[model samples]
Target: MSRLVDAHCHLDFSVFAADRAGVFERAREAGVESFLVPGTTRARWPDVVAMGAREDVAVCLGLHPCFMDAHDDLGDIAALSEWLDRHPEVVAIGECGLDARFADSWHAQWSLLEAQLRLARARRLPLVLHCVHANDVLARRLRQLAPPAGGLIHGFAGSPEQAMAFYRLGFVLGLGGATTYPRAQRLRRTVAALPDDGYVLETDSPDMPLAGHQGERNEPARVAEVCRIVAELREQTESRVAADSTATACRLFALD
Candidate 1:
């Protein structure tokens, strides 16, 4: 419990707005040192950028697949360029990827994903990706584009082979609350067996709560619990898991 990073969390989301400072305080008390807040649409990038002013937090901006209809115009990509120019300290390009659950908007998702991939390449920043039942397409796209900064496939709960598919293409899987569920035996085993460098920890907060907190709002503090569960699953000390995953996120986001 020395030091840890919540590699992905939406701290700017409405759930934490009333007590965001308290959330950070609680997380730091639990050994969570830094939190990466990813933007899900152009509209929220400003709020995320505002949060980036805090030394302990990092930010990434992109249009999320589930919010496909919200991206009003193609110029949002241009707006993204403007945001990056104005906020060069931003860590990565993401929370972007395909969601098979939204297959009807697959074409729009592809267009946004492609543009963001290119933007991440141009910005020389890593990506925070989200894919649901779309690994093959995501893998193919990553292989084709080969982003130089690489990326993290956020909230990965797939098989080890599937995780390796992303690793082979210069991406890493993100392990989170998903590992804390007893029924997630396959995912837990996948997380345990992967090479230490192949993944980072996350919470995707206010969304994917851990097993016991099914109805409560997830805070970055809970990531410390995630670290413990990951350590248990991997049969390593929590300190080891904390250090390794922190290092992985630091490298990916170019955090000093």
Candidate 2:
């Protein structure tokens, strides 16, 4: 397969602490040449930044919507702006987006998300969105906000129409372990239907384990598996999927 990129992964998470070096080594052995790691909170921004120091890794800093409690009294939005100013090497602004599952913080989620969207626009940086059950709302917001840098909707699991909606907004979808399962009929169809530049492959490591690997810690090396499944769904060769997805990710993030 052509060189691959993990468009989104939390390789900074403590779960990988003991063998993080091996993780990178294994990913490189699997042909994954780059990783985009997004920070989920202010607390981990430093670690995420440190991880980005690696030549093969890029990073994003933002307050994840699910972790509202972490941002609550910390002025994290302003801090995120400052962090971006200080870390010009940072590639994007997220792991941030609306998730309807946290009902109590629904309104707060919108508030924080809008702030980050504005930051992305002002900084002229792409985003790494983490949306769940809020695609319609997010699409509308993106239309209104119009972050020129455009971004990736990481771990996308929606209909073809939804994927097209994001593509129209200058954002590309990130296909991960979710598409490996037979149960994800709609997602697999979306994978087959996407335009040549409409999506990138991801692993969302230590989280969205691929089908048959449930309960195991996902890793960037598995992004090759994602490419294999995407190729099968699109009826293209794995090399083709790897090349197309890596190109899309490089373009979106301005990666070298």
Candidate 3:
């Protein structure tokens, strides 16, 4: 069986509240051996940690840019940093980045994002970025900050040029359910063009459900289907996609 990894997901969200354990079970049955759950706010850290404590999961902690308005105090940043120092299960520092598509407050987004970037740098942890219509700005900041250990650009839907840019920064492109859509021509083209070692696969489960699975909540079990699509696009076997992407994830997050 192909051993795959969902490099980024939010299993801590309420969407999976009813059957979170069952979700992981199905994923294992589908040959998806591991997954990463990223925290979107300070309050979710405990739950994120709890989920990661499970046998085959890892956790990433940081404030997502889309939820910048949720944080009332900067002390949360300090708390996250302290938590990172204390937890070996904390694999990276993110779910953070600029999101110009959703909100108009560019300044506020940058402030929160840059602060998290600094925290990731300080802890020497990989970042799991969430850029939406802001790849240029994200690339610029990545160049400037140059975090010692780079991370994954989760849900990547940018141009091949943009993919090359992030790849140069030691960042891996995270291809997920979006690429499974028949109309995601540009994304498919980007995936086809990317080097085998340039990305890690993900499901972004309970959100970004695959094309045929639209309207149905996603789960990590569908990650293998994602690998199949990516492999077909790249003219490679599913096992090759799964193995390479899993290795990329392990190397990026320092997973054993």
lDDT of each: 0.89, 0.93, 0.88
Cα lDDT tens digits, model 2, 135-239, are: 988999899989999999988999999999999999999999999999999999999999999999999999999999999999999999889999999999999
Per-structure clash totals for the candidates: 0, 0, 0
- CA lDDT for candidate 3: 0.88
Leading candidate by TM-score: 2
TM-score-based ranking? 2, 1, 3
Kindly list the per-residue Cα lDDT of model 1 for residues 39-150, writing each as its tens digit: 9988898899999999999999988999988895479889988988988888899889999898799989989889999999887889999999998878888888889989
Tens-digit lDDT track for model 3 on 73-174?
A: 378777887888788779888888888876676788788888888888887888999999999888998999899899999999999999999999999999
Screening candidate 1 with a backbone cut-off below 3 angstroms (N, C-alpha, C), the clashing residue pairs are none
Please report how far candidate 1 places residue 118 from its true position, in Å: 1.2
lDDT of 1 at 245: 93
Sort by lDDT, best first.
Answer: 2, 1, 3
Q: Give candidate 1 misplaced runs (Cα > 4 Å).
A: none
Model 1 TM-score, 2 decimals:
0.97
The numbered model that scores best in lDDT is: 2
